[model samples]
Target: MRLGKTYRKGGFMNEKVKSGSRNVAIVGPYLSGKTTLLESLLFVTGAISRKGSVKDSNTVGDSAAESRDRHMSVEVSAASTEYNGIRFTFIDCPGSVEFAQETYNALMGVDAAIVVCEPIRERVLTLAPLFKFLDDWEIPHLVFVNKMDRANIHVLETLHALKAVSSRPLVAHQYPIMQGEQLTGFIDMVSEQAYQYHPGAPADPIPFPESLKEEEHIARAEMLEALANFDDHLLEELLEDIEPPQEEILKDLKMELGADLVVPVFFGVAEQDYGVRPLLEALLREAPEPEATAQRRLKNIKGDTALAQVLKTFYTPQGGKLSLVRVWRGKLTDGIVLNGIRTGGIYRLMGQQQQFVNEVDAGEIVALSRLEGIKTGDTISTEQQAAIKLPKAAQLEPVYALAITPEKRNDEVKLSAAITKLLEEDCSLAWEQHGDTHEVILWGQGEIHLQVTLDRLRRKYNLPMTTHLPQVPYKETIRKTVASVHGRYKHQSGGHGQFGDVFLDIKPLPRGTGFNFNETIVGGVVPKQYIPGVEMGVREFLTHGPLGFPMVDLAVTLTNGSYHNVDSSEQAFKQAARLAMQTGIPQAEPTLLEPILRVEVTTPSEFTSKVLQLLSGRRGQILGYEGRNDWQGWDNVSAYLPQAEMQNFIVELRSLTLGVGSFHWEYDHLQEVPEKLAERVIHSNGNGGNGNSK
Candidate 1:
């Protein structure tokens, strides 16, 4: 196959001559050279005049200002290039686990993915979650072991480490030829052909290396055996010791890879352009086309009208809203109305750059301008379609939170609109006004995730923020029952002065019962109208207990009360009840109740003990731990942890588990704060004064 010539900006193929397109994602762990791989791919394809480095911060991917400042990708960057007459659009996804939602959303629309990673054994575990996602979605993918020039381990050793994490069988498509410590070339496992790497040019075909004959045979046999699991003819040929034709082997690889049954592994140094051309060739030949992907993704929905799903939403400073969508079924033209909203324009994206296009064919990812109300992971279609919706990637739950306040008080009015747009850009981020604390809490996957969000808020919306760990919504509950507490309120300066008297019984209820109020006033001792005032006063006081938090799990009863005919109004009775509660609660042994969460932490088995220790250090009560279902060599640990200890838990957990550890938590029940910690909390909250503290 002949490679296509340089594709200039805005020089897209006409619809009449267009052969086909492939949407592929470049994904892996941070610092694994995914962006560098993307730069090499675009450079070798002649889409760009020169290759840009991530260190220089000029790569086609990671072009956002935030990414440049951090020297890492904060979001998914889409770039289009043509290679071998096939229009290829590569989505460069963030490698940080914090930004994984960006990768997951982009993966939903792609035909195939290239899982890029390093050859380090210790870092192989970082690919576990990514591989699981690809397999779970049945999205065909192959592995590209990057940075081979710096490898400290043998190629077979790297493959062995990778296979432990991936559920699918890994087939070595090529074996690297190393000279001293440097990678000189690779031998194709299928064809048994050798190629020498050359800078700035295609690889030169060479004779098979006789020194590697035995090693190559072993690796080739392993690849054939893995493929034979799904092919009876190949199994028979292998059993009979017959050499299969190169075309037949390639066909088997293509069939098995497209079915998500096997993962073809290749090795190369992306920065030097070694082994990239062969990788591209494999994709062009073996990767599933858009039509096959479309049939698998949209099998349940039948439609001829244009069907597209918003993979990512962007709020460009200049262009306004750009909804990157994958066209699934029909053609999309400029100004097409989808889901009752008319598109402002259509363009293909090259990182931050946009090239205006009049129309886009199905199976292509292009940005639709000014799509209001459309969100990430939303399936959109023409109005004539039968209201079809495509399944999107699940929104990841937030595991970290911060309380944010605008630097300028006047910006509060604009906060809601800005955050709405922010959430549209990243559905994984969540914000809420805490009902109890009344603080604006921003939630996300981790600290870096929220920091990037804050940076975006400052740069895009001019809403600079001050952030801190969010306050735990604590509650105070009585530990003992107090009966027959009497109180009186009398005020006199002139006629019709306020005067009232009340007797109350307060008792502790079971945990989680909340506030309960009742009255057993007999013989009209307290007027019916005044009884309601008494209950209201009790509730008002409960909002801020003596411990400076909302009170719960207690019952207050108005047994008897007296009111003056003219001076004893409802207001007078309310004040009397407040006096009674203020006098009685102190004697009832009020204790601080902190919210506990049922947390299930998932980590690689090797780190399970460390995770248990981490939980125990945070006053967490471990329930048990067991192997994670369907996840080889991973453990799921369940525990009950106080919400106060969870502010920095994700950061620590990731640090302990090489940035792959994750957990899910939900509110459990309220438990008493430890005695020493309770003192510190009360002191921080103004020593049991009127207001709560974060």
Candidate 2:
């Protein structure tokens, strides 16, 4: 690749102008100044006249109502700008871990990403997951350490902390020059030149300072050494004590960074726009174009076909449904049919506002209105019959859940439609009507994540909801066996009389054995036709046991009964059977059983002890703990915990792990609830009224 001709006075030029475009995503941990970096980039590129502050909530990126109210990004926001002649589309992705699904989804289509972060040493571990994702997918990325004005540690020390979490090598491209406690300038390692910063304007060249020459030389040598690992020519020059040309070094940086082999680090105070121009310059010169990224993903790209991938789905109060898509291959025009769905309208999105456009070219990210059945991660193409192979981002598994109901009973019907839209907007959200508990549960990455989604439901869909802790699906079962329980029913009327008598034997079955019924009516003591009624009545009675929960792991048998041939009927027999169970279950020693789940919590090894203590406090049985596969310095702690104990587990886990921990769990088995807790649950569930006993 030729690196000399790519640079221009105003902006860097592209080797191939497929659409004269480059797409990049800005991502990092929560409160890392990603939005500020985005604002600076837009302002420096002349896309916006003035910079916007996060507190003001007037920024172009975070335009959603929920985002404004929370003062954070809730979804991916896309904006387009042009530096010189090259068009650049920037996607400002959510930094919160809960909304990482949005970032991952958008990363699939972007050419490269700028990982923004702060200089806190302790919080650097939060970037580990993001780094792992970029490396796993081979997506080119560079890290920008923001909030440099407030940095307390040396830049090199901060880089050391960041290197611990990344699999790729860290290459520092710029070194900050500090005066007392403030960052005033930076040295460009590639050019071997120093520049002084002036607020609201570009940096100006200054003579190389004598005091910092040794530090600058050491930093530059380290950068060269990192790049030399992948370039034989560069390594030869370094070994021979020959300084390589600036162009050759630039080529090495571009090549290695684009191949996902090295991460080039930059320093800045994004709130003041320092280092933003140089970062943009590096992106234009080094970041891969859409064609290269597309080739890397699709593998077998037909240049003539119209291929687009939906990165996000939205429902507008006025526009109905809108899908944010990246046109990867060919042109997308209004009224074009893609994947058998007619495009209702084509639009270029600027935050929450839409600018109507006739069509959009390949490499451009835009929204398509009213495209039904198309969802996030879906690939759309002009040829309906073609099976286009495209890379898809992995979705996040929900870690927290809420049992939700409509605020007003009359909005129940509207709630379903609103939930459908909510799922469309956020792929990480999921809902289910639990069969056992008969409650509607909404699941997401964390508490705030689900809360933001709920807020959106009320704001955008006009469907308000209430939430509470989900009820555990508890069951009742007999502990002992009881036999020869007699029940008789007799009713008389003026014309006829009703009479029935029955004797039943109730017994306990092994755990997990569901209800069963049997009959041993020799010589037809009870009429054969009436036997079905007795069984039906017994099954119905078991649904609501003496403890007010469905009974399981027990069986009942009709051993004997007397019937009058003239008065016996199925109705009389059914009534008599119910009466028998009403008296027999209590005598058999019924008890409450609660569900247990096998939980595997993955967290930093440093927090394993705390996690174990947390679990033990919640009556959790520790099975084991080991280093998580494919994750460095992390452990997956496995345990069996009662569902009741898991209700608030996620909230506490995050509090202990700096909001970086997560867990997965599934139903393992059912165990009898301890007497004390069982009594509390029984009272809480209103089962005490039904004769719950120790």
Candidate 3:
């Protein structure tokens, strides 16, 4: 249960030799110390000479062009450091909820989390989702109270604020000692050591300030109480009014953390080095190693045994496809047959760099090169090991949808490939050929999600793509029954003559039965040879009726007709059928039908009244409203509205919530078109080359 120590004598010195590393995620709310904390980790571990400032835009993980422009992280970035001989690959993830799924995916195979938070109460609100994710997934995590150097900051007060929302115990392992307006240094509750810093000087152990002894004692006692809750032995000692030993406290912390029962909270100023050494020492000693992290279950290629799981994937020009994997059960080496193919080029990932390794063992992350035809979720195993797979990620349903098209006429293929690459990079993105609208639509979390994706398309693949609200798939149908009519066509020539005759009865069927055909012709008047021909003609005419849309839910019956014995033909019958449809359709009161969608919107409850009013104005029928957990003033509202009325609903909802609300929709049913609404739709469609209705 000891921390990551190679060997130790005469005080605790970090061991420098190890064959592997740990992957940790530095995550937090927007503008928090997430990126800065990662930079500090790299600097403290000597991975970089000095941490590059986000303001300077020279940081390793903040390499995206947009990140530099905004001086913040827009996505996840990876950087590695070797401290105490244990390699730690740190992933800095975005703080915005719009990008939460990105962070979740990056944690697929990481060992633990360092949830960074600021002192401002408002800024600390978003940490709930991140912490909830860890608890729900049973992933071990630690809270890092960042930005100690800021003026008017209270570390303990911030901790209490976060504690109110957190479900698990917030155990403070490092207590920062404040002196007037400066962060003097920190006190280690576990090791019972006091370390002080002088602005630009190195950290050194010093005597505990007697003036703050009372507060430090109370803080340490609280830490002990938190430990007792998670440890049975400590609880027993606490019941007997006896203090637990330091080794017992440290041991319990490691065990509870490895079991995902407790998260050790650390305090420090990421910009300065104050209070960081203790945090680093504790992490090296307490954080779970790769062996303790969740192992991805995947099957062997032969369906016999498995030794590996594909945790992440990267697109590489040279390697074609790179799968960053964690070997969990058995060994993997170059030329070893995996998934039935001869596996080759086993290597370890060092940041953006890769190095050839003889073999990859259980409990480490490695980037396998040239795994041709292997996908991101595949499992590779030894011929004798059993296959296992990890739980599938929760699919993120997109509330907003937009149709995408290439900017240039000739770039259609390039645009399609670019979107496919984007989908591969972010599975949270839902894309498909929208059958009703026949538009290539991309659905995402929000406006920003789509905007960022478009940016990446241009930046990564040199494809210019644009998005727009998709058009509703409206249909045309008949409203009233039309009388039967006879249609005949004939042509006379010198040698042969063509003639055909038929009578068609067009009637309105039910709303959704679509097109139906029946034949009830009397004997000899119309032969059976031209019945299908008449139906085929009716089918072609049904494609575009008076309103210029395919006709549906209509019953067409062949009642009576006469045909020449030698001149009846399919073409002649088709012409006769067309004439019958054109003559009888207008009389049948053909009308356009529009699709309706059942929509459920979730927004802060404070905006509920306004949202209800807005929906009502759009002809949305409100079903009900109910409060949702953790959304504060937010409520979930359900309603049904015409699809045409919802083209800009996503945009309107965002405006109502100030960019906090979201919604989802499904096909409800088609509703009869209102006269006024139908006029507008018809006018727009007529000018857009959809053909005009008489």
Candidate 4:
């Protein structure tokens, strides 16, 4: 009853079956007992002793500092287990939308998934994003209705709600046969057996539910009917009024589930461990095997065919970057160079420790050492086999940006190195210098992501950083063209008098034409030697126009100018040109231009109105909406919004739809920021200089 070891307990003494390899992803809504379920699985398989709880901070996974503090999974953690001769690599992915990208990454390279859902209808809404990810990838996945004893909703209604969000048919393979307020046990419709947990211990076994026979028969028949739809022979046998054999039904189930045609739902109370045994057996019997998947998706490289793909990446304190991968094909032996790339040490990971294993065969999740070049989605192929690309990992666009710099001027080199290492681990983050603002900016999935990278920089890399809101690379341009303006500068300090004059016209060029300068003074009133100086001065002033932002989309024409015999130096001419730029530019009535973005959002149709309201609140224009047939009750909505308004759209979009809707945006065009916002931005950027410069 104490989650006893498998072989020692008086459970079913099943024969040792030759179970193959399978990849299982444990995903669920926030605090829906996903980590607890994974811990229980580890315990039942003898991978660990007595499941560790999040409150205790001793769970097999959820070891990150943030995860422990929040008492929730913040990162995806994977571990392999062998139960009943089947090898399954289980990934416990985070449920929070703040870390939903991490959950999406875990879904890749997995054969099937166990989506944990809470019983409360609103509480269960958190699982919508996971369902959306499953839909996008078309990955075979099942739903596990967790917290049965504490759940307020009925099991049948919960299943119906779950089915409403799924594109594929969601059939119940297990149902609860409750006794009063207590869930006495569950009926495994697939196996046609009822299991009653030991009443005294709640985890101990007892006699099956006695009164659910008639109900179990109907549920079992329906489950079989669902399976029969996938197999022609099974359908024929069912039509002939014959009950299909257990073996045949299981085969059909595995085939249909692997093909992602149907998703089977099951009820469970993970806290009491009431429904774990049947789920374990179901995984062993019906979950897809690595060989079947490998055979279906193998490629021949040079010679040896190796089936492998990186599922996750961990930056360890001692071992550095450890790329966790599941080997699906040929054997990987020590000192054996499979491919010319990264011919080095092969390691196995157990939590934070890396165990040196001599060799790892197919179905093993091992970590490779010094894999500096290996990335999260890289396929580790053998020399003989052609590399087969795994399903693409999610590419998250960075939403929040911050200007990062070394706290100390001298630590710039170290800061650069730290940023590079951070980027290597998280390819989703982007960094570049804003050429217009001359400020370096770092971009990440959200504000927390950037903050975490900064934390890691100080903690792991010893690089203290300074953070500030990134400078917007604003531009200034004219609304209308202006004719020429004659300007001159004459000054006498004593030794030499400065005297120069120029005739200039500022005209509007096509958008994005940049700044262009021309000289039409054929008579050489302004000498050719000083002509270059005038152009130089105009170009320099364009960097910070009257509005203190870059000036563009304008043409400066030097039609005529006067020169002094002795004091008419290039410097004087340049000053004359700078004066000309100040006088002629104002006539154009330049306005500040801000960056606009084209945004695309995807959300369930039920939340369409909410998403529209969010867009409208952000001053976004709704372009159009298109619904994909494959995405159940979801529509892809596109819109155009100002980039400044999209700083936190990722977070807002998630919050608007109960952390279900998502969006992507990129720079589209430039629009004039209102005078109020432009003034605020200019003041914040230290642009409080004189109104006119000459």
Candidate 5:
């Protein structure tokens, strides 16, 4: 169906922007002031009249109720503005490692990214994972060392720390001027021009201070040296002590940056809007255009057909489904149906507010409403049969889990549907119907990540949820063999009496050899039909043994039995077998067994020893550790850990490694729980009825 039509009357259809547009994502560690940077960018660009603070929850970014309540961004927030005759769409991404998936997905659609970070050297390790992602994808990025005014250490030391986490060489773009522990001004490294800061106005140029001339010379030479590595001509000039032209240095910076060969470092204090103008000018001059990004990612977006990629998905009470899509090629207009799903309305998003638009050109980021079947990372084209494949963000593995149930029993079905929508909105969320414990386990990156999802459930779906630590799937087995246990069931209360008798032999099997059943009868002592009933009874009793867990690695054989011709029945025989287990299992030396999981923990090499110590403290058996195959400067430690100890492993691991550590685990084998802990667990299970006794 043809869907081209005029949108709402007098909308942004008449407000045409320049063809030069770029999409940039602001990302860093949590509490690095990404939202504040967005506010400064918007205010300086005339997109917003007044700047809002994160404390007051009035910022355009972090507009979601969950984010505002927590005062942290939960997802990517998009805003558009024009600066220096160039259009830009800046996506503010959540810096919390728990929400890094949001930033990762948005990064795929942006031309470049501003890696906003604080000047605290101790917290610099938090940037490792994000930096690795950008480098792995070959995305051009710059580091904005924020909170420069509050820096307690030298700027060079901060740069040194940042360089440790990044794979690309870093070039200093500006040098901060400090006067008695306060930021006074900055020197542009390339032009050697000095500027003094003025609150709420452009920084005015001034003469280069003689006190910093020597230091500035050293920094500029180092910057030039880093640039020279990529250009032989520049190297020759540097080697011969011939000063390179300012224009040549700028060109090298632009070329190397756009090519993802080097990362240029800029200093700023976003709260005071310092260095924003210079940052904006650098972006305008150096950051790659959208076409360059598209060419690097998508090879065949040259066709006339409309092509776009879904970068994120959102659900609102008023608007059903909003798919945030980046138009890669061709035009996206109202009522367009791409790849079988029809788009209802098109909008230009400013934080949470939507401005209706009739048409938007390529290289623009916009929201398409009611794309029901569309999902994040999907490539859509207007051609009905066109199948185009585009790059997708890496899927994040969930490290933390919680068992959740609806607070209202009647809302069970509603909870399932709500969870579906929630997962649609945040792809990092996952859920499982645990087969052994029968718990509905919800998984995510961390505690806060799952907490935000629960809050969203309550706020958006009106479904209140209660969560608990997931129960471990534990099994039990007999330590010794017992034979010739007799069980008889007789009842004579009605016209037909029930009478059955059976003799069974129980024996221990090898570990990991699951349950087995067998029978041997002679001279028709036990009828074939009733014999099956006896086996079923034994199986049912084994499901919840004397220790209150499923029995494993054991075999039961019906050695001898008797049944009356008239009174014998399958139900009677089954009950007789169960009675035999109830009487014999306690005497068979039954013991509790807990599940052990094979865990693979990955962290920076510096934290490998800490991780090993952590595992040892938790009674985990260290199998080995080695450098991760695909990740540089990271180690993967393998261990066997009790499932019970893993409940808080992710939380503690993040605490130890600044939230960059993670692990993957699965059930490996069953081991006997320690006597002391087992006793406590048994008592707790008995009181809480968590023993899984049917």
Candidate 6:
């Protein structure tokens, strides 16, 4: 594949027009200055007249109202610019762990990623997951250590911390020239050229500093050694004490980066556009071309037919759906049919702003309007190539949930419609009309993720919602057996009188056995026809037990009963059965059973003890802990925790682990709630003390 042409003044003259595009994603932890870097890149490349700051909420990225309100990127924003002759589209991704699904989805389509991050060592751990993703997918990525002006540690220390998290080798592409605490300039490691920064202008060449010769030599030597690991010629020159040429070093960097063999690190203060120009120049020179990425991603599928995959989705207030898709193999023209859905319009995206484009070439990311059935991460192709599907990013399981209800009863009719659109926009979001609680629960990555979705619901759909912590699906079960309980129902009316009597034997079953019913009646005393009604009554009463919860892990038997032939009816027998349960259940010692989940919490090894303490504080039973598979310096702690204590567990876990910890959980079993807690729950539900049965 042809490499991207170098940048020249007044554009390329003799070289062929660079029609190929490079899709790169900017990602990092929260407050990493990704959006600011985007603004700087756009401004430096003349894509925008003036740079916009994220604090002012005027940056091209993070233009959504939800993002502006929070002053953080909550979704993926796409902006395209031309650096040199090559078209470069930057996908600015959210840094928050809650919005990682957005980052992962956008990352799948890009040729490379710029992992923007702070220079603080404490927060360096936050990039673990992101680095793992890039390496796992073999997507070439480079690190841009932003906010250098506020760096608390030496640059080498920051690099050391970052290296602990990434599996690949990290080579410093540039070394910072700091004066005390403030960043003034940087030295290009490959060229060994010193440059000073100027506000709103390109960095100018400067004489190499004599005072920092030793440090620069060490940093540059390390970079060359890392590149030499992949090139034998460079290795020979290094061992012989012969200096390698700059062009040879650049070639090695480009080749190693394109193959995802090494990660080049750069230093920058994106807020002031310091070190931004050099970062861009490095991207234009070394970042892999889209064709190289496509070759790796689509090696098996062979066709010239238009093929694309959606990286993000948007639902406009005008009731139109927009699918931001990456054109992988062929050109995508306006109004082309893909997967049986004809594209309504083709447009290029600059954040929320859309520009009409008749057609998009291969390797370009663009928005196609009114793709009704297409969703984020779905591969779209012509009918002949419909079978050619690309693997999408793994769907993130929701770690937080909220029980939601419409603020206005009239809006209830629109809730499902609105939430459907909301889920379409954010595939990480999920909703369910819960079977046990009968509540409409919205599940997402974290509190902020769901909040942004809620804001969109109110703003775009005009359906405001009232939300609260989701109720745990607690249940009640008996601990003892009650035998030979008798109940009678007799009512006199103008017509035939109602008369029915029943005898019941109720007992507790093994845990998780659920509800069971059997009849031991003899001589048809209760009559077979009325047995169905009796069972129905028992099940209906179980829907709400004496403790005001669904009853489980119990069985009831119809021992004996009598009924008058003329007065006996199904309804009468049902009432008789209900009466028997009311009299028998409380005597059987009904206990509140709360749902327990088997949770596996993954965190850095250093925080395992704190994680254990956190679990124990929440009444969790520790199962065990061991080093997590395939994750370096990480441990997975397994425990059983009550669902009630899980409402804010993620919030606490993230807070403790510097926002890098997470877990996976599933229903394990039902266990009795503590005596004190059970009492409080019963009283809070208005059942009082030992429940209404008493």
Best by lDDT: 1
lDDT of 3 by residue, 433-552 (tens): 876567888888767778777777777777777766777777888878876777888888766677888888888888778889999987667778788899999999987777767788
The C-alpha TM-scores of every prediction are: 0.96, 0.95, 0.84, 0.89, 0.95, 0.96
Q: Candidate 4 overall Cα lDDT vs. reference?
A: 0.73
Angstrom error at residue 377, model 5: 1.8
Which residue runs of candidate 4 sit more than 4 Å off their true CA positions? 1-16, 19-21, 123-129, 132-138, 199-221, 237-241, 299-303, 341-344, 382-391, 490-499, 509-513, 683-694
Q: In order, how many clashes per candidate?
A: 0, 0, 14, 10, 0, 0
Candidate 5 — worst ten consecutive residues by lDDT sum? 5-14
Q: Give lDDT tens digits, candidate 1, residues 1-694.
A: 1113232221112222223899999999999999999999999999998999989999999999999999999999999999868899999999999999999999999989999999999999999999999999999999999998788788788989989999999999998888877878888887676888878877776788898898888888989999999999989999999988776787898888989999999989999998788888878778888988998998877658889999999999999999999999899999999998999999998899999999999989999999999899888888644567788898999999989999999999999999999999999999999999999999999988999999999999999999877788889999999998988999998878998799999999999999899999899999898988898888999998998889999999999878888899888888999999999999999999999999999999999999999999999999999999999899999999999889889999999999999999999999998898888888888653322222
Cα-based RMSD of candidate 3: 4.7
In terms of TM-score, how similar is model 4 to the real structure? Answer: 0.89
Model 2 C-alpha lDDT versus the unseen true structure: 0.86
Residues forming the 10-long window of minimal summed lDDT in candidate 6: 9-18
Tens digits of per-residue lDDT, candidate 2, 146-229, equal 988888778778988999999999988888888876778888888767778878788877777888888878878989999999
> What are the Cα lDDT values of the candidates?
0.90, 0.86, 0.72, 0.73, 0.87, 0.88
Q: How many clashing pairs in candidate 6?
A: 0
The CA lDDT at 322 in model 5 is 95
Error of 5 at 23 (Å): 0.3
lDDT of 6 by residue, 257-339 (tens): 99999999999888888887787777777788888888899988887888999999998766378899999988888799999
In Å, residue 108's CA in model 1 sits off its true spot by 0.8
Flag the better candidate by TM-score, 3 or 5: 5
